[model samples]
Target: MKILVCVKRVIDYNVKVRVKADQSDVDLTNVKMALNPFCEIAVEEAVRLKEQGKADEVVVVSIGPKAVQEQLRTALALGADRAIQIETEAAPEALNTAKLLAKVVEQEQPGLVLMGKQSIDSDNNQTGQMLAALIGAPQATFAYSLELDAEQVVVTREVDGGLKTLALKLPAVVTTDLRLNEPRYVKLPDIMKAKKKPLAVETPDGLGVALKQHQTVLKVEAPGQRQAGIRVDSVDALLDKLKNEAKVI
Candidate 1:
């Protein structure tokens, strides 16, 4: 089976985010960029499926400016057979990104589609479901474990109360959770080999996906500094503070 995985470029999780001075958006000037951690997990899962002989090919794709190809190459290094970049000047919102991915899904027609539950930069967990909706495919989100057969895939997902399992037929979409699997570290040999892998670039217009703006960010701000905690002498003092100064009561 051919497995298609979606990856994303974002500020490295280790980097501290800084809001723009004008509060227009988060300041990205010269920030360190890396593949989204969850997306890396998706790529790792795809590669594992291939290694296990459950999949014939693993293809990775990303959406963004040319810079996104770096993350695509990273996926290739992680063992994807090929990479595709849906080139866009600015990062598109979730729905538009889903639309673009739907086009690719139509073209690639892979047996399975995989992606992260959410992108850390936006924390918008909408793309996978939206892509499934646009493509009319069965979807399982927040999958922590997956079992696959010729015709269907069984997914175990985490829920607030416990875990939920579902079986989805082929040509389905699955969003991976952190527990899916630990991603393997890329080796130097693999990194060198990834440079030789085929990397195709396509545009939204070429894919017939018209970009549309559905929401606007009025402003962006950093969270306010956390207040220091006060020590209470006893439970009564804590109760008094909660009932009065903190106004919990």
Candidate 2:
């Protein structure tokens, strides 16, 4: 089986995100970029399947400017057999991205598709489902545990109540959750090896995907500073505060 994994480049989780001075979008000037953590987990899972002899190859793909190649290489270093970059001036919104991926899916025709539940930067959590919808493929989202057989994949996913399990046949899409598996650290030698891995670049136009803008960002703002709590003398005082000052009642 050939697994195709979608990855993204985003600001490192350790770095503090800043809203642009003009409130247009997140400020990404000179920030350290890394693979999306959830996407990393997806890559790890795909690589693990290949390592276990269940999968014959793992191909990683990303969409964005040339800079996204950095994250593609990182995925290669982590064990993806090859990488494909769908070059765009900027990352498209979720649906457009799904369209591009759907085209790639048609071209590659992999047995399974994997990606993060959401990109940390956008937190949209919509791509996987959209891709599945576009391609008319069975989908399992927020999967933390997965088992594969000759024709179907069993996925255990987290739900608000607890967990839900589903069986999806081959040629399906699965979005991974954090608990799926811990990603392995990349060594220097692997990083060096990744440089030589085949990295192909294609444009959205080349894929016959005409990008469309479906939404516009009105503004981007940092979250408000949290207010400090004050001590209450008793339950009565808390109740009074809730009823009046805090206005809960």
Candidate 3:
């Protein structure tokens, strides 16, 4: 069986985000970029399934500009057999991305589709469900653990309070959460080997997916700066300030 893993390129989690001066969006002129952490976990899980002899191949896919090929290479280094890039000038929102992926799913017909529960940049947490809905597949979101059987897969998911388990038939969608297996480091040798792996590029138009904007961003701004704290000389002083100045007594 073939497993398809979806990954995304985003600003490295370590980098401090800076808002643009015009309030259009975050400034990303020359910031460090890396694969989404949760997507890395999804790639690791797909590779692990292949390594365990449960899958015949693990294919990694990403949708973005040419830079996304870098993240796809990293996924290949981590153990994906091949990579596909859905080339686009700008990244699509969750719904259009799902439409593109649904087209790919129709062509590939993989036994399973795995992706991050949400991208760090957007945090929409809707792509997986949208893809599943588009393709008429069962879905398990926020999955931390999975058990594969001949006919179905049981997934343990992180919910609001505790955990929830679900069994999904083959050709289903699974969105991974943080508590899933940790991603392995990519050694220099593996990175070198990944360079030799096959990477294919396609486009939304090529996939016959009509990209349309359903929403518009009015503005983007950073949060207000927090006020500095001060220490009072005594409880009386503190109480007086709270009552008179802050007026929260």
Tens-digit lDDT track for model 1 on 210-243?
8999999999999999999989999999999999
Model 2 clash pairs? none
Comparing 1 with 3 on lDDT, the higher-scoring candidate is: 1
> lDDT score, residue 140, model 3?
98
The segments of candidate 2 whose C-alpha lies over 4 angstroms from its true place after superposition are 230-249
lDDT of 2 by residue, 62-82 (tens): 999999999999999999999
In order, how many clashes per candidate?
A: 0, 0, 0
Candidate 1 — which pairs collide?
none
Candidate 3: residue 238 lDDT (0-100) = 95
Give the poorly placed runs of model 3, Cα more than 4 Å off: 231-249
Question: For every model shown, what is its TM-score relative to the native structure?
Answer: 0.93, 0.92, 0.93
Scanning candidate 1 in windows of ten residues, the lowest lDDT window is 141-150
What lDDT score is found at residue 249 in candidate 1?
Answer: 86
